[model samples]
Target: MEERNRSASLRRALTVLDHVRAHPGLTLTQLAEAVGLSKSTVLRLTAPLIEAGLLDRDRDSGLYRLGHGALRLGQAYLDTLDLRAVAAEESHRLMAEVGETVHLVVPDHPHVVYIDKVENEASVRMASRIGSRGPVHCTAVGKAILAWQPAELLTGLVLEPRTRHTITDVERLRAELAQIRRRGYAVDDRENEPEVRCVAAPIFDHQDAVAAAVSVSGLTSRITAARVRELGPLVAAAAARISSKLGSTTR
Candidate 1:
């Protein structure tokens, strides 16, 4: 009897929490009606939740909503999702939407190592594979990660040229990183490959730190400068969505 009663009470509390989440800023009466509980019973249950910081009650408007305690629990839940699986789903979606090759990579010393990829059906596709690495100074995904790197980490890193247009100057690279930060994206216009272009954005982790990047890569003939302007936001939005799935608060 004790166990059954405790289970019932727990279910009721979870139901109330779900209702508050779905209809934020609901009143006591509104929540009671939605959950089919009496107003007094709802008040009795909410009192403890509010006191525990799981729910917030607005004094000015008499509204109730989920609080920081719920957020902490949600963040904990999201942290368990496999990162590559999440990135794979987003990469497939982005590739299908943009009709371009999409890649997921983590930054390494002077390079970014590809972990996942979704290829386009174009006759001229990018010459990259799942384990391929690209120079950090010349690849869009690398720049996306580098643009968010702390100053201490950036120091003493080599900026050797991968192509004629690869950024070998530290100050120029810093300026480009500033622009990338402002725009939430980066672009590699034939800086890594002779005629290949790429646009990418950083993927944030649970702590809102950049741990990886996502990119769309293709031949310049297809991913033209004009098309780059169109694809930048699309790739960035995809990356932001993936970061959100990874429990990043930055999105």
Candidate 2:
């Protein structure tokens, strides 16, 4: 019972902080109402939060707001984020969901460097490995990230043909990138590897800039046109989850 009471108190205090964060300048009465607690109970909960520097009450208006401690905590969390570490769980989940390999890649100027790979149990394994570099014009992971990059980055870019299907024409590549932006995902239908297919989506950072990409890859027989359409949203959702973990508000 003592532990239960302590847990309840901690929850109530966190509730108060959440309310203040969502609605800054909330009065004592408004906070109490928002938290569905009595004024006395709210005060009791907020007292420790204020003492801990997680909350502050205005002297002139008696309004509540988040304090410096909250900023410190948020910054601490942001500081600990590693792109590969933050994306690992989601990458594995996507591979399991799609029954295909998942790859996480980050931008390296005109190319994307693979940082992680989660493989599915199949008779055939992907030839692509971690640390491999892929061209932005022909790979799904590359196009997913490049779609969100500045136009100037695409100018004078070398669109070397990797396969017969690779987009070598600059105008056509730009058009496909525009389509990728609209669909929130990208597809590589034997453009990078002759027998491989992939669906990918961009991951964003706290600055709302494209930071990386997550992809689902498989043999052409496994990931067909219809399957690409089916996996597009799933891959995009996985990327969005990783982006959220990276503190991105934009999906």
Tell me, by lDDT, which candidate is best. Answer: 2
TM-scores of the models, in the order given: 0.75, 0.89
Residue 154 lDDT (model 1): 62
CA error at residue 87 for candidate 1, angstroms: 1.9
What is the TM-score of candidate 1?
0.75
**lDDT at residue 215 of model 1 (Cα atoms):** 95
Write the residue-wise lDDT of candidate 1 on 1-251 in tens digits. 99999889888988998899889988888999999999998988888888888999999998999989988887788767777888888889889898989889998867899998889776466779889888877899999999998866567878877789888888899899999999999999988888899999999987899989999999888899999999999999998998998878795
The collision pairs in model 1 are none
State in Å the error of residue 199, model 1.
0.2
lDDT of 2 by residue, 1-251 (tens): 99999999999899889989889999999999999999999989989888888999999999999999999998999999999999999988888888899999999978999999999877378988899898988999999999999999988899999999999999998999999999999999999899999999999998889999999999998888998999999999999999999989895
